[model samples]
Target: MEESFMPKVSVIIPVFNVESYLAECLDSVIGQSFYDMEIICIDDCSTDNSLNILMAYAHRDSRVIILRNDCNRGLAFTRNVGLERASGDYILFVDSDDYIVKDLVGITINEIDSVDMVCFNYKKKDEIWNSGDEHIFKMKRGIYEAQEFFVDTVNNNSVVHSAWSKLYKREFLMQEDIRFITGILYEDIVFHFLCMMKAHKISCIPEQLYLYRVRNDSIMTKRVESKNITDYFRIACFIGQFYLEHSFDTRLEKAIEQYIQTVYHSFICNYRRYELANHGYILKEAIAEKRFAKIFGIVSGIENYYGRVQKKIEENIGLIKDGNSILVYGAGDIAKEVIETLNYYDVILEGVAVSDKSGNRKSLFGNKVREITEYLYKRDESLVILAVTYKFYPEIKLKLSELGFNHYLEIF
Candidate 1:
């Protein structure tokens, strides 16, 4: 490939310290069915052998371009660097730890006709590829006009904020000035939201083109630190501010409200995760600011949900003291309230059961937090409280049933 030669698509891969999976990731892209593309791998000062692997690939293939950062810049900056060097008409992001199907580029390029962006589905991979069963981005092939994309996505709560799952037109992104925000953990949320808001023609494909490797070290899989909570609040404030600056059509009002409601639920549910005393004050200040009116409107109703959750928790107090090992099935806000209410009646909580211990606290309410699967042998002896959101009820119920857990209290 010559300097003057331009590719049809640019695959921007921001590499950090992923040495073990780099070759597989690179191989998947290099062996893509589509040939007219450039693989831009920006090494973010990886301390491991990732750079050597990247160098080997770059030596073998002319299309595999390698760029290195002076320091260990984060994923957002590394991606922006790749964006600056990308010489393709279209763009696609790929994480160094993940890989895509052979026809990913070919199929997405075929569907990208006259559209600003093309989003496809992805399957989750751990030890083996598992059915993610996620509702996000699970949609039929269709094109959406200007605010229609955002409205539909938010209405269905199907916001796949990962940049890796989409193919974007370089011209549209540059015209809209859509770039990743630096120094943010959830940069994709802001970038994807901007694209959804500005894009005139966005297409959704039902094909599962990408393989998302679920690792314990991944940012989203790590424990919910104070920074994570603050970053989430920052994203909410940013979305609210963006809404204030741009006058969206009235048709999107309900959709935007629904989106805010979802974010608010998480914010309130993770309130106990904030470490600093001023964290509540930060939210209060955001509420006071008119720019965050959309966000804080739901924030105003935070206490209302508590009453209902508390009432539900109290109703299950009698069954808790029936001589079985008591455990809470969730570690969220409602779980905290359940524990507190149970403690009010001097009920002893044996443990807390979580889907995964990676993203949750090691201990909740002074009880050791373990995976729900760990209690399969003790299912008969444990009395569990399913304290989770309404949206997750069906999935949790099914999981409990599958694990042979019969005695459990359900909280909406």
Candidate 2:
């Protein structure tokens, strides 16, 4: 590849402490069926062997470009560096720990010529290239207007916020000055919305190309601490301001309202009671703002529903015997809430049950995390609590029933 020769796609990967999974991610990128692609890996002063692994690949392939940061910059800043150095016609960001299918580049390139951006589907897994569970793009495959695409993404809860699993036109991003918000937790939210709003035409393909690794240590899935919740509320405020500044239509306003409501629900359900009480005033002030006053009712309703659920659980607490240990299924935010709620009732929480064993093995709430199968064998008689989202409740319930575990309950 010559200096003037531009590739079809520039794959930007921000490398940090991902030495354990960098090689597999690079291998998938280098092995893409599409040859006219540049792999840009920005080493963010990683304190691991990630740089060495990237160097080895760069030595082997001329298309691989490795950039280094002088100091330890966060993901958003590192990604901006990649965007500045990118020379391709299209841009695609891939986390260092995640990989994509072989045909990802080829398929994206085929469809991207007709639209400003191309959206695809992804699968979540614990290991690289594990085809265990996949989430396909549910929208029809065709070009859509910018607003239509935005509304569809919000409604479907699909590819609205994630920077990955989508191919972006470099020129479009540059022209609109769309870049990730540096030093923020949910930086992708603003960038994603800006790109979608600026894009005149977008295309959706129902192909599961990217494999998202659900590591408990990842920034998005890590334990819900005070800063995480605060960052979420900050992002919610930013979204509200963005909508008001643009003066979007009522339909889009409603979509954003729903998005805010969902975030509030998750925040109330995940954060500890004391933490919420300490930080609840910030949310109240944000909602009281003139721009955000419309969603106050939605937020209050979410809190009311949470209270109702807590009352229901309190009313049914007598059903469980004193000796019965509680096992929480799912190790995400919802599970943390379930554990906290049960502790409020003086229930004995045994441990957390995760679907994948290869993920973060760290203990939560001082209880060791175990795979569902291992947990069942260890304490089959414990009262199992399905601490997952509402959409996943039925499927998880069916799974538990098939495994001969009748002592299960769902907190929705």
Candidate 3:
């Protein structure tokens, strides 16, 4: 290729022990309709065949560039190495296991010329499940001012705080000196937040082009350790300090506050009592400073709201008749919690019903997993408990009712 024909997008993939899915990921990138792209795979001292796979691809494709770490530095440092080595006009970070749509680069490149970053949507899947075309929310496609984008995304919860689904201008990242927090598990939390703050213009597209594979080995799926709990607070403190250092408008300040509050709420929900006790002082100090009053107020309101919801659910337990079969809809983390709560109460269940798009699973929570359509066909007079997030509750309720299911409850 000539110098003018250089790759427009430099895809930085940080590879670890992902031999099982590496080929699929590489194939997706190499087969993209937009072929003017360089694939930079950073091998973080993998013990598996991940490095060899990258080497093989490099031998066959001139666009493949293989880099290695001397030792096993974590994802943050490895990504930093990729950022330093990237040569394209725009940079995209792709996890080794995930794949993207064939025209993702072409679509993003066409829309990203006047924006600092382009944020797109993604689908979350399991080993067998693939969330095809179903997105959480539909966002308008246009260029947005930085504050407007932050309000629509981080504040409204339309976008996830992840780097993978976004395309960044190489010059913007370099000029802002944006880098990940080394030796931290949830480094993306801070990095993504800072990018939104620094970007002058951001473009939002509704296309679900990225496929995020949910696996047990991933850090987010793993049991929450004390380190993970502390990392949340660490990032909160970092963001709080950054806010103090910079002068932002009231709207942006409120958005940042909401973002930090969400992170703190997640920490409280996931951590044990002992872990909370250990880090409770940080919360107390933040409150004392009065800088996070909005966060505290939001957290307090959420607690009260959830408490009322829990009370309602408890009082309505009598609605479930004795010996009535129960079918839980959704097979996500919240669904698992619902199943466990039912098990604790010794409630018998018929089975778990999942959407057709999620593929099929043998079982969930020791109950057989059946498709929603199949379960609907069985005239079991079952009470279907929709165990999904609050945002999807209304749509799910409407769908179940349309399918002729009379008895259903949504556990937000």
Q: Is 1 or 3 the stronger prediction by TM-score? A: 1
State model 1's lDDT: 0.79
TM-score of each: 0.76, 0.76, 0.75
Q: Per-residue CA lDDT of candidate 2, range 69-122, in tens?
A: 999988899999999999899999999999999999889888888789998888
* Per-residue C-alpha lDDT of model 3 across residues 1-412, encoded as one tens digit per residue: 2457587889999999999999999999999999889899999999999999998999899899999999999999999999999889999999998999898998998889899999898876665323232446446778888767877776545657789979999999999999999987889989988898889999888888899887768766676666786677678778877877888788888888877766665554444322456666655554464565555463443353223334444555777545377888887655665675565456778888876635444566456667788876653587888877789877777777778777877665
How does each model score on lDDT? 0.79, 0.76, 0.77
Tens digits of per-residue lDDT, candidate 1, 208-248, equal 88998877677666666666766767777777777667675
Which residues of candidate 2, in runs, are more than 4 Å off?
A: 127-131, 273-290, 296-412
> Model 2: clashing residue pairs?
none
List candidate 1 segments past 4 Å from native. 127-137, 274-281, 298-408
**Candidate 3 C-alpha RMSD relative to the actual structure:** 5.9
